[model samples]
Target: MTDVAVPPPAPTTQTRARAEVAVAGVRVAPPVRRQAGAGPSDDGHVRLDGRGAALPLDPSSPFEVVDGRLLRDGDDVGLEVEAVDRPRFYDLATADGVPYEQLARLHGTDVLASTVIQTCIRYGEDDRCRFCAIESSLRAGATTRVKTPPQLAEVAEAAVRLDGVRQVVLTTGTTATPDRGARYLARCVAAIRRAVPGLPVQVQCEPPDDLAVLSELSMVGATSIGIHVESLDDEVRRRWMPGKAHVPLDDYWRAWDAAVRTFGRNQVSTYLLVGLGEDPDELVAGASELVARGVYPFVVPFRPLVGTLAADHPAPDPAVLAEVTERVAAVLRAAGMRGADQGAGCAACGACSVLSTAGG
Candidate 1:
C-alpha cells in the first residue's frame, strides 16, 4: 500500500504563533504601561482569550491596542481584545493587614497564581539560576516569602468571586526539604479545595526527591503539575542554573516518570527556555524527549528579568521562537496532548506559549 499523506494544519494556527512571537520577543514602547502585575509580564500585557493569544502591548512591539481591539501595527489582525481592568482582588487586604494581592495574583486571562514560597534555597549568589527573577518581586515587597493555606484559600475565594477566575496555579521557590516544598503545595491545594471545592488547582516545583508527594498532590486535589527543567542541554543548565544542574538528568527523568504516573499524560509538564546559548536543534530534541515521556514541554522564550544575572541578555529572535514552537507543537499534537485539556495551571493558561495556539 502507498504511504498516507499528511495535510498541514490550518494557516490560522501558524498565524497565531507568529503573532505570539512578535508579542513575546519585542519590547513595548513608551507611553504604554502594562495594565497590571510584575511577576511575568513586567508591563502592560493582554490575553486574546477568544483567539487564543497573549501579548505584551509595548512601544517596541508591532501589536497595539486601540479603542478596545488589538491591531497589528495599526491594522486589524482578525483578533479581538478588551482592556482588562486590574483584578478586583488587588484592592483587598488579608485580615492581618497582609494584602491579598501579596499572597496571590492573577495570571493570564482567568488563572489565579502565587509563589507559595517566594524565597528559593538555590537563589543565593553562587547557586541561583541566571534567568530567574523569583525573588526580585519578593525583595521589592510585592509578595511574602510564604503563603499560609488559609491566606491562599481566602485569596482563591475572593479571586473567583471578584474576577471570575476559573483556575489556580500554586508555585514555590525550591526549599531544602527532600520534598522540595511539595508538602506545602499539597497543604495549599487541600486548603484551596476546601474553599473552592469545584475549582481546579495545579502545582509547580522542582522535582521532589520523594516521589510519594507526587501521589499526595494528586490525591489532595491538584489537577496538574509543572516540573520545569529550563534547558535539556546539561551544559546550558550548568551555566544558567548551576545548582539545579547538579541534580542530574536521571533524577529529572525519574521525577517525570513518577509525575506522569501520578498526574497522567499532558497533565504533567516542564518549562523549556530557549536562547540560553543552547543549540536550537538540541532544544527541539529535548522537547521531543519530554513528549515521548508523556510530558508537555511548555516552551518559553527566555526574557531576562529585572534582577537576574542574565538581566542584560536579550530574548530569543522571533524566527528562532517560531521554529521551536512549530516543532514542539507538532510533538504535542502527535502525542494527543492539548494544554487546554489539562484543566488548570500554566500550561492550561496557554498565554505565555504558542503551542496551544498551534493545536498542540
Candidate 2:
C-alpha cells in the first residue's frame, strides 16, 4: 500500500482554536491547539465525548494498544466530554424482562444507538470481522440477547423524554434473512417513530440483498442511512471482514446508489476506516468516487477496541491519519457536504472520525 504524506499546515497564530469537529458524525467542541513538536507523546489525550478524564491509556487497558495510543482517532481533535446523566428510564424495566440500557446507549449528549440484534451471523472466530466486538457486550451480560421492536420503541421514548435525546441510530447484526437485518432495523425505526413522531433517526446495516429495504427504512422515518463498506480494497475486506467479503463490492455500490435515490445525496453514507493496510492513495480515490456518486464517504480510523480481534494491532501513524483526513475532507468540501448536514448517523454523531474536524 502506498503512503501519501500530507505536508503539515502552517502554524496558526493562536495557541488554541475553538472548533466544532465531528466524530462518528456528531459535532462537538474541540480545542485545537498548536503542539510544539510532532510525536505520539506530543499527541495529548482528551475525554471520549467530553465527560471523562483525560487519562492516558495504560499499557494494559482493554482498548487496543497501538504504540501506546488508544484507538478511535484520539489525536485528531480534543474532546470536551459532555456530562450525560443517566436517564430516569434506566431505572425502569420492560414487561418482558429487559433493561432499557440493553436496547440503546446514549451517545455524546443527544444520540441514542442500539445494536437492534445483538448476535451477528458472522460472529464466529473464523468469519467475524476482526474489528467488531458486537457480541462481546452481550456475552458479558452487559446487554440483552435481542431487542424487540416494542422494547426499542419504549426505550427510545424514554430516552427522548428523560434525557432529551434528539436522534436515534439503529444498527443490527447481519441476520440470515435476505435483507441482512434491514427488516429488523426498519421495524425498529417504525416503532420508534410511532412512539415519538418526527424524531430524526438513522439506520445502519449491511447492504441488503433487496435494495427496496432502503425505501422501507426511509418510509419508517429513517432520515439517514449507513451502509458501511468499511474498506474499498478487496484484499483488505477479505483480511479484515472475512464473512462480509463474500457479499462483493458491487453489491455495496448498488446499495449505495439505491440508498441515495431513496434517501437523497448526502443522506446516504458509508464508513471507510483509514487503517486496515489499504493504500492511502486508493482510500482517498475511493472516497472521491463515493462523493461523486453523492454518497458521503465517512472516513474513520480503525479503533481496536477491547475484545476485538485487532486489539493488539497498532493504529496507523497519526501523521498518516492527518493526511488521509485532509484529503477526504477536500473531497467532501468540494461536494458541499458536511457530516452535521446529514442530520443523523455516525457521521452526524462525529465521535469516531476526525474528518469532521477538517470540515468534512
Candidate 3:
C-alpha cells in the first residue's frame, strides 16, 4: 500500500505548538509535576488551551510558560498555559495512615490515576522495557508497592468528593497470574464503582492468558481499558521491550479483539510510542490498522526518562512526531473515533499525546 502524506499543519496553529511542547517539553516548574513513574512521559501537568497536557519540565527547553501564556524564546506563542493545582484529596490519608497522594495521584486536572501494582515481573535489567520506569516511583518511595482495593476505593471517594475527579485510571505492572493483573484491576474497579456509584474508570494491563478477564473488568463498571502495546513492529518490540515482546503480536491482537468486543470499539485503546526505531510510514500504517480493528491508537512521543535503560536516548524529532500524529489523527477522524468518546482512560484524558490536539 502506498502511504499518503498528511502535510504538516501550519506552524502558526496551536497544533504545532502542542506538538513542540509534547516533545521538547517546557522550562517552567509547574505546581503538579510527574517526575517519573509507570509510563513514558515524566512531565509537568498543565492546561494548554484549557485541555490537559503532560509536558516535560525541562529547564533547557526553549518553550516556557509565562503568566498564563506559552512563550517561545521569551515571546508569546499564542497558546494559553497554566499550572494544574495540587488536588485537595492529596491532603487526606487513609485510616491505616497511607497518604492519599501515595495511593493515587491526580492526572491532568481531574483524572485520578494509580499503578495498583508497582513492581513488574520484568524489572530485571535484561527484561525491562527500555522506555518504561514503572518501578522508579516505588523505589523512590513516591508510591506504594501494592494499593489495596479498599484503599483505592477510599481514595476514589475522597478524590471525587474533595476534588470532583471525573474519571479514574487503574494501571498495574505485569504480574505472574494468568490474568496478568487484570483480575486485581477488576477488583479495584468494582470497589471504586461501589464507592462513587457512576464514576467512569479505565483499567490498563498487559494481554492476559485468559481473555475472560477483559469481560470481568467490563462487568465491574470499568468504562474503558488500555492494552498498551508500545510498538507493533516485532523487531522494535524485541529491542525496546524485550520481556513484553515475548507475548507475540498475535496475543496482543487477540486480546484487543476481545477487548473491543467487551469494552466496545473506541473504549479499547493502545499506546503507540514514536521514536522507538519504527519506520514512520509503518507506524502510521499500524495506527490505521488499529482504527480498522476498532481500537484507538494513542500516539505519544518517546521520552528518555531518568532510571530507564533509554535514559540517555534522544527524543524523536518534533517534526516526525507531529507528522505521525497528524496522519493517525486523520485516520481517527475518518473513523469517527474521538478520544473523548472513549469514556475514560489515557485516551479519554488526552494528556500525554498530541492526538487530541490534532482532532483525533
Best by lDDT: 3
Can you list the residue pairs that collide in candidate 3? none
Candidate order, lDDT descending: 3, 1, 2
Report the C-alpha lDDT of model 2 over 1-360, residue by residue, as the tens digit: 224333434322110111112112222212321111100111112334332211222343323213322333444333333333556767768887777766677654577778888889998898888878777777777787788888988998888888788888888888999999998888889999999999899998888988888888888789999999889999999999999999889999999999999999999889898779998888888888888888898876664456777777776655667677777887788779888898798788665566655767
For each candidate, C-alpha RMSD in Å?
A: 4.1, 8.0, 1.6
- In order, candidate lDDTs are 0.76, 0.70, 0.90
List runs of model 1 lying over 4 Å from the truth.
1-43, 49-58, 72-78
Q: Which sections of candidate 3 miss by over 4 Å?
A: 1-12
| Weakest 10 consecutive residues of candidate 2 by summed lDDT | 33-42
Cα error, candidate 3, residue 136 (Å): 1.6
TM-score of 3: 0.97
Q: Candidate 2: deviation at residue 327, Å?
A: 1.3
Q: Which is better, 1 or 2, measured by lDDT? A: 1
Off by over 4 Å in 2: 1-82
